[model samples]
Target chain A: GAGVSQSPSNKVTEKGKDVELRCDPISGHTALYWYRQSLGQGLEFLIYFQGNSAPDKSGLPSDRFSAERTGESVSTLTIQRTQQEDSAVYLCASSLVAGGTQETQYFGPGTRLLVL
Target chain B: AQSVAQPEDQVNVAEGNPLTVKCTYSVSGNPYLFWYVQYPNRGLQFLLKYITGDNLVKGSYGFEAEFNKSQTSFHLKKPSALVSDSALYFCAVRASRLTGGGNKLTFGTGTQLKVEL
Candidate 1:
């Protein structure tokens, strides 16, 4: 079975630019999530989407961060006016169900973003 | 609030020796714990999880984790180590009730494990 997939494994951009990262969740996975990992740091939650309900944007670091998921499939995380502090590995994950506490999330190979 | 801790920055072991990567967690409610391994330049791979029932959970690639409620620990262990097992390890925790609508995961700082031949 195909797993979660993210595009543009690596990205380098000038500071103050905007970047969009893409994610393709596994078929039938209604729950999608985005996380960030800075160098030598742990994973930080960003945003999550379940079905067509209002997305959970609580983890977004600031107003400049946003994400959208069309239906239950593809998702995109966008960071506006990126800064040097925005550089990190962006990771995506998906789960079959979004309601349970025991649900397991499968992760994708992350996109490494570098701001210079 | 939910949090996970990997006290050790790194763990070293010789091939064929028993290995243990420690993990502890804290959550407001019931805790669902998990373990993951990450190879360099690769995505994190799930090793195992502890939702409930049995305290000892078995997982992929001959890996296992033991859950201790009193200590709030779920440590990853293997009978013997392999050179290929060297990688970064992480412990994660999520609250049981889905009341908040967030249900986000809280991860640990991570521990680097090196298996020497």
Candidate 2:
């Protein structure tokens, strides 16, 4: 089976420009999550979606960061007015289901975004 | 909030030697600890996880992790190191759903493992 997949393996953009990163979760996965990995830092949680439930935006660093998932298929993380600080590898992951004891997330190749 | 800590910034071991990568975690309830590996320019690959029941959980590539509730730690280990095993390793923790925690995982600062021949 195909694992999670992310598009635009690399992106270079000017500061203040908006960028959207896409993720295609494994088929039948009901949960999707976005995370950011900055240089010399741990992966930071961004947002997550479970089925049709309202997405969990608690991890969004600021109002400029937002994510949306249409059903359980695809998810997009959008950064409005991107800042140099937003430059990092954006990773996406998905699991068979959310909040289960056996749930284990599979990750996708990240989209590296460089904001100058 | 749950959190994870990987104390060692890097671990170097000789090939054929045993290897150990330390990890500890804190959470409100039972902890679901996990280990992941990342090769350069690649996404994270799941290694193993400790959910419950067993203290020693075995995973891919001959890797295993021990869950120590008393010490609040889940350390990754392997019987023999391989040069190909060198990579960035991450430890993550999540509070069990019974505790009303969300699905997101809290990751630790990664630890680089280098296995030399």
The worst-scoring run of ten residues by lDDT in candidate 2 chain A lies at: A39-48
Best by lDDT: 2
What are the interface RMSDs of all the models? 1.3, 0.6
In model 2, state the lDDT of residue A27. Answer: 98
Local accuracy of candidate 2 as per-residue lDDT tens digits, B10-106: 9999999999999999999899889999999999999999889989999999999999999999999999999999999999999999898888999
DockQ of each: 0.73, 0.92
Return the TM-score for each candidate structure. 0.97, 0.99
Query: What DockQ class does candidate 1 belong to?
Result: medium
Q: At residue A17, give the lDDT of candidate 2.
A: 99
Clashing pairs in 2: none
Candidate 1 per-residue lDDT over residues B27-92, each given as its tens digit: 876788889899999888888988889999999888999999999999999999999999999999
Q: Return the TM-scores of chain A for each candidate in numbered order.
A: 0.95, 0.97
Cα deviation of B51, candidate 2, in Å: 0.5
Q: Candidate 2 deviates by what RMSD?
A: 0.7
